[model samples]
Target: MLHIEDLSYETGGRTLVDAVTLHAAPGETVGLVGPNGSGKTTLLRCVYGTLKPSAGQVRVDGTVLDGAKERARRIATVPQDGQSAFELTVREVVAMGRSPHKKFWEPDSAADRLLVDEALARVGVTDLAERPFPGLSGGERQRALVARALVQQPRLLVLDEPTNHLDIRYQLEILTLVRELGTTNLLALHDLNLAAYFCDRIHVLRTGAVVASGTPAEVLTPDLLAEVYGVRAEVAVHPATGAPTVTYLPGPRTPHATTAPASRPSAEQKTSAM
Candidate 1:
């Protein structure tokens, strides 16, 4: 399991993330949802070891992350924007994930190649394996990146906005693929409906803290939506799937007078309005 205890991050005397704690167990998928600037990405960064927490510990399998390189190897991350500077083919990019398993200056072996191919196939990007990395579309590139992470064979996979630039089909495709992998996953997502449908549990962050953590049915109430997002919405179960569905309503509108000119007849006003 991946465990975070009292995690916090500060920069320039301002706290970006407060004392927060969360966890993801093996074979579980946890979704993180919040409004913009709520420190969802920051908390994920801490999980992937990209950023150090100012006042907490990130532990994997009972080992503190700071002192555990092996534990770090068990964690893999896919960030929001999938950009790479290497002028390599998709196969080469996916093959790179095996570096964590190799010794310094070691060359890629046959086992590594097989794993890379498997990972590419797993993400449904095997057909584009020979294409140049920079030539792929946003959705294809995202899949390639995920394939790279899969090649690492991590116990915990952390993704930040994995579906940010994708279409609806790709969004479902990616999350479904992740779910099928059956690895421990922690994903930061903006689409509430997707979270409600795909996540086994969810952590709702608001202003650098986790305000709620539970199953979708327990946490995604209309009151929580209004309190956290400042929007009025109707929450109901999907007719067929029985999953939670949220329908947003427009905010209160200003009252306007419907006064007609003296020259214009009242009948004209009634007909024109209709």
Candidate 2:
């Protein structure tokens, strides 16, 4: 349901995202897995309308994605961090997702409230519904943001590190919840294991370009891991879930081969990409 073609984002003579192209079919969870500064977040921002691409196009459900209002109705994004200029209750924050479907001066309807409550419950943030958004813990804030995206009833969900501050339990819960949602999901994830388990297809990025793209089994090989992440890892299929499982190995690489140098972006670059 989401298609990005030859996407590129450049800033200050540096190319953060370079000629990247990928897609997420309806009800499929497509993952972008890469190390920091590899342009995963930059590509996501370009797709979700947070950043305009220097080149390429983003299309949703066969049509080109344009305009903020229409984009909000079709695509909902859960950024790595949530922010607000003014204090808003959790419920109120989620209720804002429905604004795209309403007139500028229109108030929330009874149906909108129900959707907000349902979304809150779905993300397990019902109790925080009355709390201030900024006062909550990072994980709580992340879940609340997901609830807000859910309330939007978006056709495609773009989540950039949705599990960033979440614990193991919440990590599993959030990814599981997203998997079960059955929406077209485009996720930028740091956890290769989680991406292998949850995503139908995986795309690996390196130095602002797509280095590899395929199913988890095809992309998560030990050689690819070492080449992209500069880490030694053992990849195998799980017996229970039938998904690829990654077991990272410690120690340096062999003397004959040198590990790939990771591209490290600054904090400001990361924030702007997000």
lDDT of each: 0.81, 0.86
Q: What is the TM-score of each candidate against the true structure?
A: 0.88, 0.91
Task: Report the lDDT of model 1 for residue 28.
Answer: 81
Q: What TM value does model 1 have?
A: 0.88
- Per lDDT, the best of the predicted structures is 2
lDDT of 2 by residue, 1-274 (tens): 8889888999999999999989889998899999998998889888889899999999999888679999999999999999877799999999999989999989999999999989999989999999999999999999999999999999999999999899998998888788778789999999988887778789999999999998887788778888889888777656555567788878984222223212222324423432
TM-score of 2: 0.91
**Cα lDDT of model 1 by residue, 1-274, tens digit:** 8788999999899888899898888788899999999999999998888788899988878777553357447888888877777778999988878877788779998889899988898888989999999888888888898999999888889999899778888788888778778789999999998887777788999999999998777777777887888887777766544556767778753222222111211323322322
Which residue ranges in model 2 land beyond 4 Å of their true spot? 254-274
